[model samples]
Target: MDVDDYIGGGSGGGGEALIGMKTVEAPDDGSNCLICLDGGGGGGEKTTTEAWVETPCAHRFHSRCLESWAQVKLGTCPMCRRELTAAAAAATTTAGEDVHVLVADPMVADPLLARWNLFVQRSTDGSRSMSSLVRVLAVSHVLPDEVAAGGAWPPPPPHVVELSFLDNLQVSKAAIQRLFFYDGGSLPPFESVVRSLQSSLAAVLAVFLPLAGKLAYLPEPGDVVIDYSPDAVSPGVKFVEAEYSGSVDDMRRLASDDEHHTEAFLQLVPELEVSMLPAPLLAVQVTRPRDDHAGGGGGAVAVGVAIHHGVADGQSVWQFIKAWAAAARGGSPAGQGLVKLSRVAADVIKGQRTRTFLLRADQIRSLKRRISRRIAAGEPPRETASPVTAYVAIASLVWTSVVRAKPHDAADEAYLMVTADCRRRLRPPIDPGYFGNCVAACYARANVGTLRRGGGDNGGDDEGLARAAAAIGAAIREQLEDPLGGDIEGWLQFHLSLPAARLTAVGSSHRFMAYETDLGWGAPSRVELVSPFARELVMLLGAAGGGVQVSVSLDEAHMDAFETSWFQTAAGDVTV
Candidate 1:
C-alpha cells in the first residue's frame, strides 16, 4: 500500500478534522474482532445490537474492547499495530513545523517514578515535568581509586571552554541515542549491573569533566561555553532506570530486523531534556526485561546513552563508552582525550521511517572486484587515494538506489553529502582520542538522468553501482584536501538551500567498530542509533560479524522502492 493510504485520515477521506472515535453499526460480513475473537456484532455472542468503532486502517473492533485496549496500548490499531493518532498528526503537519507525538500508558505507574516526579515538582516548582516510566537520579563525581586513597573531599575545578563554530552548528540537532544489548547468562543480577554502571560512569565523568557540564550562553560576549561549577544544582549527569516488558528474544528480533522499532527503542533511551538552556548535556539509562516470577538473573540488559550532539561526535562517544567499560571492570579510566572541532549540517523533513540493510563480507568483496575492474579499464578511478573501499562501494550503492526510488523532474539534480573524519588531516594533527566533533562534510552531485542511466555507460546491470562509487570516492578526495573551505558560518543555511527531495546525507561510519563496546559482561550483541536527526540521513556502522550495516530513513513508499531496487541490483546472487 502507498504511504498515504496507510496513514490517511478516515474512512471518508477527511483529514485531521475527522480523526476521532465514532460509533457505527457492525459490518454485515462475518469477521471476528481482533481484540475479543468474537463476531463483531456483540460481546457474548453474535448479535446485531452492538456498536463498533473502526480505526484509520479500516480494522473494526467492539467499542468496549477498543476502549480497554487504548488505555494500555496507546493509539494504535489492535490488529495491525499501526499508529493511529501519531501517524495522522504526521500526515497533516504543515511545512516548517515539526510534530512529535508520544503517548504513554498513564494507567501503569511505579512508586519510584512517582517519588521522582514529586521531587521534580517541588524542585522546579512547576517549571518542568517528566514522563512517569522514567526515574532520574543525580550521579555525582566519584573520585578514582588512586585519588580516593588520599581522602580528597572534592576534585579540582573543571575548565570553562568556549564552543567552536563547528560545535555551534550542532546546537539545534537531536541528541545521539545508542543502545547496547548484552546477555545476562553469566552476569550478576540486574540491580548489581545498574550499580556498577552508575559508579563507573561517575568515575569516567571525572576524566571527561566537560560532559558533566552544561551549555551556557554568555550574554556579554554572545558566546556559548561548557559551564561547569562544583556547587550547581543537580550538578552531575542524569542516570535513569527503566523496564521493558518484552523478552530478550523479542528485543533481539527487533534489533536484527530490516525495519526499526522506533517507539520501543526510543523508550529504552533516556530523554535528554533540551527544552531549556543550561540543560543536562548527558543522560544514561539501563533497562532490563521485566521479571515474570522467573529469577531475573538471566535475561538481556540494555544500556542506553543520550548525549548532546554539540558535545561530541561518534568517535568521541565510543571512546567514553570504552573508558567507562574499562572502569566498570576495575581498570583505569584515564585516556589521552582532548576536545577537537569540525563542521556538520542538518535539516528536517516529515514522514520519514528507518530501515537497515546488511551487506555480507563476500558481497562487499564482489562489489569491490567489480569497481576495480571498471577502474582498470582506463576509466579514471573515482577514488583518488584508495579507490573502492567498502565505504565507497556501499555508500554509492545506497545513493543510487535512493535516487532511483524517488520521483524527480527530468532536469533535477541529486546531491550526496558524506562526512569525513579530520583527525589526521588537520595542519597540527588532532589526537585520535580527541573527545569532540572532528569531521568535515563533502558533497557529490549527478544529473538525475545520468544516474538513472547507470552512469551513462550502458555497460551492464551493475554499471550504476560503479558510477555511484566513483562520484563518492572523488568527493572524499577533493574535500579532504581542504577540510574547511567555503563560508563556515553559512554551513547550515547552505544545506537548507539544497532541494530536500533529491538530497541524501550519510552519518557515522563502519570504521567506528561499534560492536567492540563491552561493559564486563560481554560485548553488545547489537548496537543501533535510535532516530537520526535528519529525514534523509543514512547511518553506517560495523556489524558484529564481518560486514557493513546501513540504516536508511525515508518515507514509506520510497523505502519500499529502495529495498526492492537495492536487493535486486546490489545483492544480486549474494545470499545475504
Candidate 2:
C-alpha cells in the first residue's frame, strides 16, 4: 500500500497525482516506473501526469498509485499482484451498495453485463476440459434487523415450524466441503472477496436467525414448517462466485473416487431441488481454482455448503461453517463451540461406491484398548463398566467388517444403526446452539453367526471383538438414557422394523471434530461424503493423519468383500 504514500487530498509540491487520474504506459513492461522510484527518473521525458496505469494483470501503475490503489482501496496491485477493472471493480463501493465485479475478461466487451443474470466460467484444465460455467451472480437477501412490519405481517406465528425426531427422517442433504489454501497467500480481488462474503453472510443471518429461513409443507398441520418470512430468506444465500482453470494440484483432483468427482462438488453447492418444497434451506459456493483463465492466480479456494438435513447436523454443519469462518475471517457471529451429532438415514441407492480409509492415532489407540478389554470382560446383567470409544471401536469394526462383507443368514439379522445425541437427552434441553435436528437412533442387532469373521466357532478374535463392542456399546447406552423412553417412538420403530435387508448404518461422529471445520482455508485437505445416496452408509471422519476416516458405502459387489473385510490387503487408500 506504499506507492509514495499516495497522498493526494490537496497535493503539495511533491504530490500532484489524483486530480484527473492520467498515467498510461501499458504494453508489455520495460520497467520505467511500474509504480515508483522513476518513470520520471534521470531518463527524463514523462508527462501527461506521469503516465503508467495498466492492469487486468498487465502490471504497470502510477496514475497516482493506480488511482490510489485500484480506484480507492484494494482492487489490488500495489506492485503487480494484478486484478482491477470490471469497470474498475464496478466503479466504487465503500458502503453504498452494489459490488458485482465478474470478470472473465477476454479483453472485456461483455463478460457478463446486463446486471449479471448469469456468468458461468469453468476449466479445471486437462487441456481445458473440466469446464464449469455456473453463473447466477446476484440475488441478494440477508435480512436481520428482525424484519417484520409491513403492517404486522399476517398475524405472524405458525410460519409453522417443528420437525424433530431428527428433523422428520428420510435423511436430507448435508455436504460440507471447505478448502481454502492460497498457498503462500494473496487473493484480494474477486469483488473484494465476494464483498466480504456478502457482508459476512449478512452477519451470519443475524446469528443463525433461522438460517435465513425456508423449508415448508404446512398444508393443514400435516407438519413440516420453517418459514421465517422476510419472504423465507428471499432466496438469498445462493451467493456463488466460481472460476476455475485448475491447479491447487488441479483442485485436489476433485476429492476423487470419481462419482463424477462427487458430481463436481455437487456443482459447488446449491441444488436444493428436493424436487421442490420451498426448499433451499441454505446454500453457498465460493471457488477459485485458477492456473490459467487468463492471468493465473491459483492455489485454492473452495467453500461449498449445502444444507437441509431437516436443518442441520454434522454438528449443525460444523457450527454453521465455524460461524461462517469467524464471520469471514474478521470476527463476530460465534458461540456454539461445537459438539453435536447423530442423524442417520439411508436409501438412495444407485450403483453406490464411496471409499476413503485411514485410522492413524495408534490405530485409534489400538481400537480403544481392544474395545476396552472386551467391555470390561462381560458376563452377568451387562459386563463392561467403561472405556471403549473411538465411537464404540469404530462402530464395532464397521459392524464386523460389514457383516464380513456380505454373507448372511445364520438365520438372518445383521443391523447396526446407532447414532445418538438427543440434545442432553431430550425432555426439553436443546440449546447447544440448537440449530436443528436433534438426532437419535439406536438399534444394534447382530447374528450372521456373530458377524461372520470366522463365523463364530466358539469365539476367539478376542471374543469377536468383545462381541462387537458389547453390541455397539449397548446401543449407545440405550439411546442416551434419561427417560428417552420411546426414544422417538423407538427410533420410529427402529426404522420401521428394519427389513432393509442386511442393514448397516453407523453415522458421522469422529467426535464431531469434522476435520476441525477451519474455514481459514488451512485445515480441510479432505472431508467428503457427497452422499450419492448412502448405500448402507458409514462415514466417520477425523483423520487427516491423526486417525479415523472410514466413509464406506459399497456395492461393486460388496467392494471386494468390503475391501477384504475392512482394509487388510485390499490395495491402499482406495478411491474409485
Candidate 3:
C-alpha cells in the first residue's frame, strides 16, 4: 500500500494528540529502572550501590556504572560507541514545531509499555535481546568510474528507504486489540528509541508487544500498533493506524516502488536531522511466513530493511527482535530494552574495566609479524592493500563457486555484490546504541564462465574467488579487532586526498551472497540473494537445521544438479 493508503489516506489529524515533552525522571527503587529491575547488577553491594540514570536512548543504568566498567578497547558504548552526554549530543537535536506524523497502532493507545514484558522467561537475561541474530552490512558501492564517468550503470540516485512491519495473522483479533488499545502510555525515552534502533543494526532480533492480561511491553515491528513521528522537532508527532492487508507481496511491491514509496521515505529523513550521514532508522517492518503448504516450493515473507551502519550491527538488531517477540507474545518483565554495551572507566582500577589499548597493540603486533613473515618467505606483491570484510570474502567465494558449478552457461554473466554496513561509514551516525537494520549493499563481479571457465576467451580454474573471500574475512576481522587510526572521517579524508585519477577509477558494485531466509514455517521455498539494486551477480543463501539454504541463477538444467551436489557436500555423514 502507498504511504497515504497505509496511513489510512486521511489527514489523520483528529486522533488524541500525543506530544513529545521532556522525559519525567523515572521512579527510583528499581521501579522505573530497566537494569536494576532486570538484576543486571552483580548483586549484593553492586545492586545497592547502583542507581539507574536514564539515558537519552531511554535506557537506564547506574550513574557512572557502565561508563566506568571498561577503560579502553571499545571505549565507546558496546552499542556502537556514540557519545550520550547531553553536551556532546546537543548539535544532533533539532528544535522546532512538530509534524503531524501517523500513529499506526490505535488498538493499544495507552502509550506506556508494561515493565513485566521485558525479560525472556525461557532464556538468560543476556540472551533475551535481538542483537544476536545478524551482523554484516550490505552497502551499495558507487564505483569511482560510475560517479566520475557517469552513465555506465546508470540509475536514478538511490531514493529513501521504506521500512514496513509485518503483523502475525495467527494472533487472535481480540488479543491484538487488547495489546493495541488497553496499554498505558509508558513509551521509552527518545534516547532508548535511538539505542534500540542501533541494537537492531547490530543484528539483535526481538519483538515487543502490549496486551491487557499482560503489561504493555516494548513494541516490535509486527505488533498490531505501529507509530511514526518526525525525528526532529520541526514536526509534531503524529500516529496513524495501518490496515493489515495480510499479504507480504503487496507490502514488498509498495515498499520498493521508486515513485510513491521513495517519496514518503525521503519526507521522513530531514526530520531526523542526523548530523552525520542521514542515518535515520527509517521504519521497522515485521514479516511472518507460515507453513500452510509445507514441503512445497512456496515463497515466504521476509522483512527488508535499510539501516545506516553508523547505527548498529546485525548482532544488536537480533537482540531487538527477541525483545519485540517476547513483548508481542506477552512474556514477563516486558518493556525493558537491553543495557548499553560500553567500557566503563570508573568500574576498574586505573579507571578501566577492559584493556583500552589491547586491541591497538595487538594489531600493531600482527602487522609486524606479517612483515617479518613476508620478508622471510619472499612472498609476491599483494593485489590490494586495504582491509577486507567477511561479507566481501564470502561473496567472492560464492560468486566463484557459482561460475565453477556451471561451466556450460557462458553466454550469461554473473554479477557480484557485497552488503556494506554503513553504521560507521556514514557521516553523523545514527544513535550508536540503537538495535535495528543499519546496513547497505556493496558488490564486485566478473563474467565467471566467460572470463575464466574457458568459454570464449579466458580459460582458467577460478582460484581468485576463494582466495578473495578468505582475504576479505581476515581483513575485516583485523579491523574489527584492532581498528584504524581514525573513524570514517579519517578514511574519507584519506580518500579525498588521493590523486583525482585514482579517485575516478574507484569501483563500487560487486557480487554478493546473503543468508537471510529464515523459514520458521519450514525450509525456504527458494532463496536467491539478489540485491534490490542492480549489480553483476547476486546469490541468496539461507540456513536450515541440517543443511544450508542456497539460491543461484544459472542455466535451468544445471540448477537441479547444483542443488543436489550442494546437499551432498553439506550433509556429509559423520565418520569414525
Cα RMSDs of all predictions? 15.5, 23.3, 24.7
lDDT of each: 0.63, 0.52, 0.27
Residue 553, model 2, lDDT: 71
TM-score-superior candidate, 1 or 2: 1
Estimated TM-score for each candidate? 0.70, 0.30, 0.30
Judging by TM-score against the true structure, name the best candidate. Answer: 1
For model 1, how many clashes? Answer: 0
Model 2, 23-88: lDDT tens per residue?
344332223444322343221344224445544344454444344333222244544443343333
Predicted structure 3: lDDT: 0.27
Q: Tell me how candidate 1 scores on lDDT.
A: 0.63
Per-residue lDDT of 184-204 in model 1, one digit per residue for the tens? Answer: 576567778777997887677
1 against 2, candidate with superior lDDT = 1
Off by over 4 Å in 1: 1-158, 232-234, 292-297, 336-350, 378-386, 453-459, 489-493, 572-576
lDDT of predicted model 2: 0.52
